[model samples]
Target: MRQKMLLAFAAGAMLASCGESENAEGPEVADLLFSGGTVYTVDGDATVAEAIAVRGDKILYVGSAEGAKAYVGPNTLTEDISGKIVFPGFTDSHAHLPDGGDTILGLGLGGLTSAEQIVHAVKAYADAHPELPAIMGSGWELNLFPDANPNKALLDEIVPDRPVMLVAADGHNGWVNTRALDLAGVTSETADPVNGRIERDAEGNPTGTLRESAQGLVSHIFPKPAVEDVVRNLEAGLAYQAGNGITATIDAAIMHDHNEAAYLEVSSRQDLPQRVRLSLLAAEEMVTSMVTPDNVEAVVEKLVERRAQFRAQAKDRLDADAVKIFVDGVPENHTAAMLEPYVNAPLGPDHRGEINLSEEALNAYAIALENAGFQIHIHAIGDRAVRVSLNALEGAIETNGERPRRHHLSHLEIVQPEDIQRFAPLGVTANLQALWHFNDAYISELTEPFLQEKLHRWIYPAKSFVNAGARVVWGSDWPVSTSDPFDSMEVAVLRKNPDDANDQSWIPEERLSVDDMIKALTINGAYLMGQEDIRGSLEVGKQADFILVDADPYKVLPEDISDIRVLRTYIGGRQVFSAAE
Candidate 1:
């Protein structure tokens, strides 16, 4: 009985024309009624609803044709979507929107094969902005270079007169010309900072490349862009997110600078199409602005007060529940702390991943913050860093009893199987970006020699994590890779390198199904952010946040999934972005 009825209703919901027959007398009135499509409501039991009726911003009804009709009115418009698919709006769990936007507008040297090509691209930009003091570019690939490392020598050839600095693709390193180095006062005599390294050539000469905090040395000397420029970059990023059906994103890093202030203004004005979860970053010394040693309790109180102000102003547009902490940088180029020595670096055998803070310091800070009811989004890319974070998290919880707040390991790019189980116990979410599997070919090669037994393991272990009952959400890590959720979904399922077929993909068994992939991009992401109760899936009372695609995902082959186009995107029942209209 009830089971049969549910199955029949689900069948009707899967078909586009079934709803029409239910109301054959006339069209049922609805502000918007989408019928006849594969609608994936990634809610409990993974319900497949037939028709979704929207009245204003929230879902009026979501069920079979019979259930949807009760909410219809005389002026409602019904859409026949027989050849389409509807899923909750995607969420990018971690990305640098402004950086990505600026990169898109700047010189594109993401995959240049050699430093010479990068110099040429910079020269082309210089030709137009001849009066500009120095050239600033980003997105350089070390793997693409013949020497597998870039230095200032390459930049000197093309622009010896002008100071030039190019940030590495990972955002952890920089390559500067000799002129830029001299202007910044970084020389062979400059000692490497605690959390950074200055790469050098033979005879103790400073090479053009600076890793981690060392890059900050050269960047501080450059003139900063205007607030209008930051706003423009943010607008570009917002448009990009809307085009890709991304409804929200967690910015990986937010510094206490004028650019951030301008971003908040833009966000409060709703100029940003996508919702932002801003996480402020600060050093231990800088924490005094919001906290003090004598009145640490008062500082926590102020942090909350400030967050409330931002939330009230931005309304549903901003979430200020977390603060970011950079645990360590990337493992490539020997900046990312590793438990073992680099497989192919000049460094000795006893090298380990860098720790920006002592274990005690990290544990104490996290505990204090958690007790104050603020979430901590830790940036940990390497396995050693993950271990340190896990240890710190454990210590923090021990000091302060477990609370309902969420903790995240922002780029869990390399997790051991054993760590997967710990995530659920530790209340940590794996914020993974699957698109890296498509764009980055060096990850596997660089990791193989280090983890010999677990060589070439897939970074986003979707199946294993799901099996372990661990929550896994997808992210774009944009600016580092393309910010297309469809592209990311396509890569996660197919496990095929679209960029280079010759590059073999690993752990095919770890790939997720289309159904699971949709959930990770939608409800799972919402769940991680504590927004699942109001948004995420399509259901009665849930916000009408979804996108309509041209082709039905169920009918298309996995490889052809990326061919599906987003025709329209709706947020809170409003047509925020429409491609056709």
Candidate 2:
């Protein structure tokens, strides 16, 4: 009797009467109904409905709560969502998120912002677990050290006897101690790999820091965790994403074959709740040791096999059909390939940093990958890096002609005006990392000075890309930075630090509209992974993937958008994450 009264009251708040005059047989009953809430249906018209109805895994009706009542028969489950806000579930287009779960299981270094804090935390973790022979942890911020570089002495002071490996929050660089280096036998005589760096001092001795592929040398030595341990971390990470209102992810890196086992193990248990599109990475060794005109056939064959293997064995929504290319490194380390030299050129006057592969080689590789049916996802930061990656995609198109592939480029940090227009014509999606658009400590301290005023103004041109008719999308790059979609949407709309929430924007003209951000966070991202036809929006026939937040983003101030909390997340009309629980 109480439930009936509540439902009747909620039905009063329903939208304008749609099919209110039901006939003799009555209206079709829906299995589930959500009413008395603001539903931001990110559809073609951007409809704001008072109720949404679902039957099984697909959306049945999205109209007035009064209309919804006709579908709410005795067997229908009803939710009176008064004062709540609903939106399509967010898709983190590009992220490395296994760390989200791994951090919870063992030693985590997320919030430590100081070097002293990090070293002591490593020492404390080492002390607490003396049985471990090596210590490994991530989430070290770049602003904590000079030029995002760290050496061994501080860590050596703490645990000189044990092997210590601390990875930067961005996952591009690594810090190690003397013990680990000695174990790897990386002396001054050890030459840097083709696409990596082993930071050294004036005397050419290893400074205990590794960048790019160089970290792989020592990281391969760490003992592998048990299969069950990996499955637990994978589950925890996926749930963490769901808790943040994310229903899908384009996992930006898959370094080895073993990485597949844990994800497969979890999927076999029917525990996989989110859509994952893994981007298989090509290491420096593979390009140098295996790729050539004569051996390219075998290289292409291996790539195809791996992509097919992941797609074929799926108990749940798990897939891998994309390839990842690190065209250059980040500017903080002076490894990003730029058209002009960085201010005061750290390496040399004419130096513009590293380019992992020659343009010729990249063109060949791109053509092969595309011909073999793999979408390419390139990491290009500097202006020159962006140009070269674009050139490679252009070559792929000319060689293989056009099919249906959503090839994309991530981290367009310093795109030139000419290249900005090239993205749409060449058919590449500008996968914007919107969270980094602001003038934070990292940008204020190192980035501004490094790029200077000239090139710095061109940073994260969100509106410009959209104006150029390029399909733009946003990503969290989690484990590198914050993964909250609200935090990211806030930054994209304000072009200022969400935490600061100040009036002084980074580059005001680049600020996106609220509608622009919602589209990027939803449909645009789904299109990038080829799932737009099924999900990405709330409509009559689409999958029931959406979230209920604490407040309506449209009603809140731009600065307060980050304060919106995810109350409940639903995928396939089934509850996956609930904050109240």
Candidate 3:
């Protein structure tokens, strides 16, 4: 038949490419050979191959099964991956791996939809671990509660004796019981810190809700997790990522001083399964103090020193070449800086949120870091914040000359039309959380009212950026959102809540194609992390990082993408995870 003839020709081509003798070979040679599957190369041509061969940690050949057989020696480990789909291992462009791990191990509040569920879960956890000195947890959404603000009295009703503090889903707010507030000495007179707020009642009493930088007040009182605990949580997180098909991730914000050491220790012991890029926290103090002209030089010098120290102690598995900066807070808290006035400001109609760092200061800081050979990753959640971040990066590029390093702006929740075009020309990466572009309770209840008319116009302009020739990358911002790439991809393409598929798609015009979403999760993420040449695609000579899926994402309905589970995961020619095993 014609099919048989085509197969034979493809096999012949593979044999020719491998340069192996079919008749004289005692035994072929390769560390591993995977055959009989649809291999998505994700290369320039997006070629689909029938088989692939790996030698040690590198891919030796990618073609037909006949070609791969040439490299199959006596020691080869072969896998017959029939009726499956293979893709380049996913990379979460931005995530809080350690925090996610900690949350999983501690009080997990990931998917609860109501206060009753959260309270019941917390109470159960507290009862199970009565030996603990204090209780700490996160993953509570503001929109889940009435008025988008959680009350401390609810937490007090459960753990009236032991102190309890739970962080908001966004990681920008915190809720604590009365005992926790007392433990932190947070009285009504405890003035709010710069760039942070302590939400209070009408009577001027502390409401037990802390926003932005103010969470540090109570956090400082909580006992730090032991080093072993930290490592254990990190490993748990890495394993979770691998199970979900992630081979690489960037720890977006390294806030604690000991986190760097923990990462280095893990990398040295070869326990880290995924490639990790760390962006150290440089925004908290710098944003508050760097506004003064005299303070800019000192702040930049300090950042440069931190970079040098990290690089000197860097390991091969972990990279520390970027710094994370927060431009403003989230819109739910009314802290995200906006160019125009908020629709109904509590203080006044003219109030338009707050900007942590001025435009000039951000520009200077970016320029200094860019000149010192470092990439900048900024969190700009509002329209004005996004514009200011773009302007700062532009100023840096103009002043320091365009370098190979590509700067990133994350959480593009609201980007102006004019700013959408700036990304391509300035070579800026739109690091977006695709899972957020949907009709979720957070969007419909908490965020939409504030934006008023601008709500539809400014929410996640992903397609616009891609059309403008800008490289768009995807991230989960885990511990803040779901880290599953499938979940994110589904939202990106469908523009609807994956949990409630029947819900109407929000801003469906901005939806992306499956192909574009795949690129954002794989190649684009790799490029953002500066690992494009070595990984990202399933090409020969690249690191063998890939995963086997239960179904083909391209062939299935877009809504079913998130339902397709990862059957197996491989890195450096070694099997790292398997559903069966």
For each candidate in turn, the TM-score is: 0.88, 0.93, 0.93
lDDT of 2 by residue, 1-581 (tens): 00110101111232443222234796667888889988877766666788888888888888787778778888999999986988888889887756667776777788787988998888889999999989988888878887677888888999999888888877778899999998988999999976678999989999888987788778867777777777777777788899999999888877554456676555444446688888877554311122444555676777787777666776546677898888888887778889988887567677787678777777888888898888899889999999999998998888888688789999898889899999999879999888888888777776768775788789878999989999988888887877788888777877776555334688899987777788898989888988888889878778889999997666677777778899988888888999973
Indicate the residue-level lDDT of 490 in model 1. 68
| Alpha carbon deviation, residue 261, candidate 2 (Å) | 2.2
Candidate 3: regions farther than 4 A off: 1-28, 283-292
TM-score of 1: 0.88
Q: Which rank order by lDDT, best down to worst?
A: 3, 2, 1
How many clashing residue pairs appear in each of the predictions shown? 8, 0, 5
Candidate 3 lDDT trough over 10 residues, lowest sum: 1-10
Alpha-carbon shift of residue 97 in model 1 (angstroms): 1.3
Model 1 residue pairs with clashes: 13-50, 16-36, 29-73, 30-76, 330-336, 337-353, 337-354, 338-353
TM-score of 3: 0.93
Candidate 3: which pairs clash? 28-72, 28-73, 29-71, 29-72, 29-73
